[model samples]
Target: MSFATPPGWYPDAGAPGTERWWDGTAWTAHTRPPAVVQHEPVRQPYAPQSFGPPVPLPPARGGGRTRVLAITLSGLLVLGAATTAFLLLGPDDSGTRTAPAPTTSDPAPTAPATASASATPSGEGGPDGDPAVLVDQLNGITLAVPDGWEKAKNTPDDAPTIRTAVSYDCPGTAASFCYRGTVSTRTARAGRTDPKAVAEADITAAADRAYEEDILGQRTHGGITSHKVLKAEPVAVAGRTGYLVRWQVVTAKGPGGVVQSVAFPSEAGIGTPVIVRLAFDADRPELPVSLMDTITRSIRPIGDSATSGGVGASIGP
Candidate 1:
């Protein structure tokens, strides 16, 4: 290939402040300073010529050879340094590097803190003294009911119910006057945050849906007398804020009642508030008068007796 540098003494490519001879070919051990020009007949520097193997020049004198040796050592040192510098500072083959651009996005949602795992049971007991402990995994709650009261599973198709219990054992046995009950829990389909409001809304919706049959005289338990709200107040259940709704109803059996108790979960693990209702029909003589009170007082979140937190779902009161 063609070459730029011709046969002449030029500054050493490897060593500064020194010149190296290139006899129309390869670098030679013959080196000198720029001020020390060879004593050859001065002529124009050799022009580019046919490139081939390097043609060695005659050896230099004692002093000249020593200078060449010295320059060669220094040249090696400088050359090494240059190579290292190139590796560190040289531009990349493509171009310079740059950091990526800043980005903007919505923050990710943080999970709710884990609640205590033990459930704390609180409430008054029944005549037997040993209240019935009821744990509901679906709704994430536990409560005490009148001991021996049977838990039934007779949820309607259209109505939302997580649990059901009766005041008496009615597996298949039917009686005119029996205390039938239900536990309903619901989360707002649209993600309502206010627990108490949602719970009251649930109560209103329930009444609107079944007021005629369940509350009014449209349906009969022997014969419906009068159904009216007797108590409505704020109460805490399972360490959550909620409301207590009591409706007194008169039927053929005697003076019975329906209770709607709702509460919010500590951690909205399911991303919504919860409403729980414990409705009892105590018109039946067989059902104890204190059954409703027993269950309501003993209500708690399902877990160890120390933790209080409820799960999410929808059910009827």
Candidate 2:
């Protein structure tokens, strides 16, 4: 009989009750006696032993192709499990996956810019928390409103004016109020360009306006009777050289008043002349003769630089 098998022990045909080694392709001389068995005796008749075909013997050790195949399949299952774990977890090596940080597409918010306060304009007028100041927006100047004086209400349409706090019935007409002291300002009229000439020319008109009659032809101070010059000289007003004319006047009825006309170049306007007319009742002993000088010195250009001291010749009583 012929057989094809790997190198191992097998049953030998030529040997009885024994086994021999077949080295893969051929029979070998190596042999071993059958292993002795210890068992209970059988009660049946014995029969002759007959060998039919060569049978492979069991392996002497535990290692074989079956064991190797089992190892390979186990290795493949472990590898599959490891690959599944890798797919489930993130790249962190500590076996725990880490989450990604939050992100935003919008830009970061920024703070709003702060705004600053604007400066007051030159041509604007209002009380600067000082009740004694008179702001004149037209001429861009401020006057020190003297004690016992206030801004005049119902002023004539001809000019901006201020007057004494006290008023009484007009001597000639009881229908109106008359102030003992007044100061008015106006832009110089055309053809009266020179300061000295304008002052000289307007003195009489100023006196007439104060003591002669009102715009409605009503005698305010009983009409002027005579007048005399008190002061006529060049003086510095609001940082500009100017001329002033003061007159003491006599009236038809009540004691007459002192009137003055001051002309100067406007500090803010296009070098145009400005006129300031002042009047005070001569009968009032409370009004000082030097009050005109105080008023003239107190005139200042309006705005932040208004506090600067006036530097030049000044008017006196």
Candidate 3:
């Protein structure tokens, strides 16, 4: 006996265990065979799943609502990516915004004509040995003092005196006169420096007092403390040399004590020569600067008449 089958034929000969006939395509006569039973297959229980956050579903395969949803989701993702990129890569305006220019430390150098003077014979500058040679070589303008003119100490401090001139004392007309000289040093002028400034100051200070006394008080009508330079200036003195200097600023002590000081800088040379004139009388203060004209006229340079860089200082090492 043998079993044979045709193409596309099914084995569904019968539902229960029994002999059956087949027409190759369908089952036919059934014959009782043996008693049997069927049971369902056993399966394991499924465990719960875990995830971080809810995620949207993707479109199903083929066309319809699923396809439309897939296209819409893809477009939304692309749009979001573009927006993020634009925000991060945009140009920055903060760096290029300019601020005001910074301020300057000093004013531009002054015009040469107004500050500088003509040149004077150097003679050489202050003394290493010969007093005359020393005097001749001094900076600022040069002034010749009489061979044996009286001299006075302007300051007790022993600070080296600068530009100056020696002459007879003015306090008295006696046989032995007072020793006095107009001394000065190069110093910053009105925001600058001038060699001749000290002499100008000394003259101006005295002139100012004289003018004031003529108008307001008497020569002996004292009441001012003192006068000093408010600012220094560079100017030609006796003609040549450069000078750096300060000025005469008047100080009034209540009404009785007065000191009259005038300063003029000579050109700056090896030493800072200057001319300083002072009139101080604490006990019996002088009311006016009577010697203003005389002092101004008395100034004389020791060397060349041409003035130059007298204010340029070449002082202590």
Candidate 4:
């Protein structure tokens, strides 16, 4: 439905007692405290009554009439004061009341620049400090990493599935690292046409391979076990259609490992689709999956950065 009111401030439908901007087509992020409206009591001229024969009464003494007039005027004054007080202090017709002045503690997102910055998602907190913004010129993507997370030094140079990879390890962990998140721009094989299918296969293979190695290392006695794919579904990443793959180990002992990956193709001319994976021990709560999702969704392709469909075309299976 269209806005019946012209472009201006209106009570926010989502938040009562707050004003939101109606930008003709839609409500904008811009909002402010509601405006207060004060009503005043209107004074009407007092008309004197004429006592006719039907309402006959004895004539008043010299100052009796004056006293009566004085008392009547005083009562009118009191009534006027009461009406003014009610109008000033009583709740509005809707039972909602706005402050006398707009609150300034939380300013409105009226500035386009401020709104834009806020629109970009970032980690709530990072160990290194405030979340740091990292822009990958080579991959044409940008994301925010938690503070205190250190980037791994050994990024593979010859991994085919990963054109370039950047891994961040959380603080307070030894060489093995406790929690880790990685962003990689994947490159398909020389003749592979469907990157989505390749990505899916690569994701599955990675999970199986990782679990196999884990079992072989732990089970020197030759007991074989497998990892399980918890979920695999089509997802919209960075405006591009992609897939989110989640898998976990099936072991009775120790901390079960979990892997969450998001893979999608890049838009035309913006290299291949990238995949972001976050892995951690199920026992540790350090791994932030929501932050991982934010990083994956923040990716942007080289020339198609302005487009909302992420870094790639909107094609997925």
- State which candidate, 1 or 4, has the greater lDDT: 1
The TM-score measured for candidate 4 stands at: 0.41
For candidate 2, the per-residue lDDT at 234 reads: 99
Candidate 2 per-residue C-alpha lDDT over 40-154 given as tens digits, one digit per residue, 9 for 90 to 100: 2211111112333233332323538546756876797788666666666656778577555443333533322110001122333334334566655445466777767877656
Regions of model 1 farther than 4 Å from truth: 1-133, 157-179, 204-226, 250-256, 266-268, 282-290, 305-317
Candidates in descending lDDT order = 2, 1, 4, 3
By TM-score, how accurate is candidate 1?
Answer: 0.41
lDDT of 3 by residue, 1-317 (tens): 11112211111222332322222233322222321121222110111122221111221235366567568767876886666565556545874523433433336333221101112233433222322222322223332222332223343433223222333432222232222223322222332234354455445544344222422234322223355544344434454443333333333321222223334443332223354434323232221233323333334454332422122222110
Mind giving the per-residue lDDT tens digits that candidate 1 earns over 1-317?
13223444444435565544554445544444442233332222222222242233323234465568668767976886776666666777588633333444346433221111111223222111222344443244555444335434454432234333434532222332234555555444445767667766766554332222343323334444566776677776666666666665555533344556465653324345556666555545434435555445556544433423221221112
Query: Please, what is the TM-score per model?
Result: 0.41, 0.57, 0.26, 0.41
lDDT of 4 by residue, 190-211 (tens): 3444545656666655554333
TM-score for candidate 2, residues paired by index: 0.57
After the best TM-score superposition of candidate 4, give how far the Cα of residue 312 lies from its true spot, in angstroms: 20
lDDT for predicted candidate 2 compared with the true structure? 0.64
Candidate 3: count of backbone clashes, pairs at least 3 residues apart or interchain = 84
- The C-alpha RMSD in Å for every predicted model, in order, reads 36.0, 52.1, 48.3, 26.3
- For candidate 3, the per-residue lDDT at 31 reads 20
